[model samples]
Target: MAITDKFSSKQIFKFLPIVAIIIAGINAYYTVNEGHVGVIKRFGEAKDQQPPGLHFKIPFIETVEMIEVRTRKNAEKMASSTKEQMPVTIEVSVNWTVEKEAALDLFKRYGGLSQFEQRILDPRFRSATKDTIPQFEAEQLIQDRASAIQGIERRLTEEMAGFPVIVDNIQIENIILPAKYISSIEIKQTEKNLAAAEEHKLERQRFKAMQAVNTADAEAQSILKVAEADAQAILLKGRAEAQAIEAKAKALKNNPLIVKLTEAQAWDGKLPATMLGSGTMPIMDLRNSQEKGN
Candidate 1:
């Protein structure tokens, strides 16, 4: 008489495999990576978030979704124009991340993060860039590049205020302008440069002319001073000689013999053949005396 067992040893061995499979399925777990967050859900709906390592959820009924929590790059293109129907092209990029406290909420509301590009990023960024870029001109975009990027950042921040994302910053990489307008501007710049060169040359010429005039004036003044000095010396000498002659004449007024001797001594015996306005008449005594001295 033997007792019947509920399971045979073979059946238990098969059950052993089932039990191992169940255990293995239950043991399926993951670690949330360093810069990532996990969204845990029940029946494909987000329930909670786990951060940075070792997480477990009900194996069959619960689901976990991993999302990158680090900052992400969204490189984009934008354009604007000067109201004059001018077309422009610009390259833009943004650094962004999910708001930490809102990660779980975002996953829950936005259908588990599959629609980030569509629901959150694309629309919001497009709205921000379009709204802000159209306000600037082509030249303004080139010159105020930093300000343009800042505008995009500010607008994106404002647009995403109700969302669970943060715009770390915006970068405007480059701007392209129309070829015709740029060429015209370059030509105008060349003309401006030529005008500046002409102006500089004229200024130099004017400076040189002024220097020449100043030098000529200085020389003329110096010559006037020298001529005045020479004339003054000649006048002084003439006055001294005239005074000496007058004194001698007064002294000779009392003595006639001394006058004759003075006249003889004054003669160099080179007398003129004719006197002032003389009619070739006899000036015999004066001629005879000068010839005797010679």
Candidate 2:
């Protein structure tokens, strides 16, 4: 029994150093997750920065803090007013990331990400949004919303200068206005639409009137042309009749016997029904034979 006890005590003393070495090895190394960086601190002072994956540190002397370097979102809702003193509620979201080069500075200044946001980012974002909202009217906010968003983003980015976090994007998620104001705008727009429709109706009426006047003028011109043509035809016909009468009168003046010849052409070869006493026969060449020779 004494021989067995001596052998167990010797084996136990030999494994003590091995057990301590394994425990120390386990406490010396740490792993940083994907998209995360580790910051090393020695005796509560920032010492060095480490990238993702396995890293070694002095156990119980140096501490490692894992900071997510990936993009993070911070959203806020604020109540503000327009230039017209119209109350509005706006929701804004900011996308940010810790700068790898400035991680140690960030850790030193704010002590952590939460403290950085609370001390710097959130307050500046609220201030920027408040300052911008008062510069715009309610209508301008609705009409030129994109410009409003840009102004807020510019101001926020400007405020974040020299900070350890990078401002990737700023978005205005929602803008809420008073219900009464929206109803008034809708009413005004409806009136404008009605006025535009009325103006369009008047234009159509004017166009129709112009078309009717043009049609009447064209009809008048057609009638005048037809009357002129008919008058010209009548004048030509009267002139032709006068010319025929003048030609007949000229032929009679040239030969007086043409009238007797024309009358004999129209006479019948029969005796008269009755004759007066000592009256010569009608249209007869009753001259004597000696007179005819002279």
Candidate 3:
């Protein structure tokens, strides 16, 4: 019975190679998904990269590492100082993707995404941000954040020139300033707004005053024109009256009978009941008296 058991164990050992071969075959086939590349390594040495598809490898001796080629986002927060030596906390997010052709090389150099981020991406990002942030003062960084973000992005791109990763975009998520400084800025802004409002009010009052002056000038001019017109009319009326008086005096000199005729027209044809000592007698017209005297 022991001989038979030993023989059976030897037989199982002989089939072990077939089972191993079956397992190797099963592990040889790997599918690289979309937006991913498979980095092939043989005997622990990087060979090349394969595109998205089913791929075969020599199973116990060859290995494949799936590398994502799609864009990915990473965020990091760091503490830095401005040119004015003001401390700030900066949060930045980056969009990045590995270069497909350099996948094997990237894998060989940094092993994987986690290792690459630790060794290259995170450190370079922090370095670039720190290097660029100190170039601007705290106020300038706050006032012109676009310029600060551009500077950091440019520096980071430059730092990643020879690396196998493409930086699609970098955004400065937040820049936290000191609470005291923010309060001071708010106070200053409030004062500035108040001053501007006061200036505007003064300007409005000045404009109203100017309008009033103009209206008064216009009214004065209108009154002066009316007075001048009235005076001219009065002068013309007086001249016309004087002219009539002079003509009437000339008529009276030319014809004295006009006075007797006017007096006859004004009389009531009644004799005075009593005559005063200085009163002149009203003469009565006698049509035939002149003929009688002649």
Candidate 4:
């Protein structure tokens, strides 16, 4: 029995080194996934960075921590006051990622990603939003919303420059104001619209009045033109009648017989009841006088 025990003990001693090596190998090597970075630490101090894929470390002396370096999105709802002291709720989305070159410093300072966010990112974001709000009024915040959003984003980028993380994007999702303020603004806008409508109506009335004045002036001009034409026609007709009378007087002066002949032509065949002059009546019919003598 002693000889069998001695053989078994030698065999166990020969396999013990192999078992120890196997255990050390299992603990020495680790794998980092794509889009992740490994921070190797020695004696609780960050010593080196490891890229993705398989990496080895000293067993029992070195440790590895994986941090996601890819971009991540965080949404926050923050409250702030505008320049006009109007309280507002702002919904913002931030896309950020760890700077690969600053990863070690980041890990050393904050210990972990969650700690970094809690201690640095969230506070800085809140501060930037709060600081930006006071620069604009409540009405401007609602009216020039896109400008306000851009301002907030620019301020956030400036604030985050001191951190080890890069802010990829900042989006202001919404700005919500009080219901009473909105209602007041709507009422003011309605009043403005009514005033504009009244002004337009007055302008239309003025235009119509101008049109009526122009029409009246045109009609008066037409009537004046017609009156002038009628006056010209009457003057021309009077001149023509006077010319005919003057021509007849000239003919009577040249030949006195024309007057007697004109009188004879104008008589109707009836004898005058009494003679006004003691001269011969040129218009008397000689045949009638002869018949009366016989």
On TM-score, the candidate that comes out on top is 3
Candidate 4 similarity to native, TM-score: 0.60
Q: Please report, as a residue range, the 10-residue window in candidate 4 with the lowest summed lDDT.
A: 276-285
Give me candidate 1's TM-score against the actual structure: 0.63
On the 0 to 100 scale, the lDDT of residue 171 in model 4 is 74
**Number of clashing residue pairs in every model?**
0, 0, 0, 0
Better of 1 and 3 by lDDT: 3
Q: Tell me the spans in candidate 3 whose CA falls farther than 4 Å from its real position.
A: 1-22, 224-294
Model 2, range 47-142, lDDT digits (tens) per residue?
A: 888988888999778899877889999999999999999999999888999998888888988998999999999999999989998899998888
Kindly give the stretch of ten consecutive residues in candidate 1 with the minimal lDDT sum. Answer: 1-10
lDDT of each: 0.79, 0.89, 0.90, 0.88
- Residue 19 of model 1, lDDT score: 95
Candidate RMSDs in order: 8.4, 7.5, 6.7, 6.5
Between candidates 1 and 2, the lDDT winner: 2
User: lDDT value for candidate 2?
Assistant: 0.89
Model 1 has an lDDT value of 0.79
Clashing pairs in 4: none
The C-alpha TM-scores of every prediction are 0.63, 0.67, 0.72, 0.60
> Cα lDDT for residue 11, model 1?
75
lDDT of 1 by residue, 1-294 (tens): 123454576678878988988886776776888887888878877778889888777767777788777898888776655546687776777888887778888776776445776778867787777777777776666678777778888888888787777776788777778899899878988999999999999999999999999999999999999999999999999999999999888888877899789789999998666465556565544767788999
Error of 1 at 96 (Å): 1.4
- Candidate 1 — number of clashing residue pairs? 0
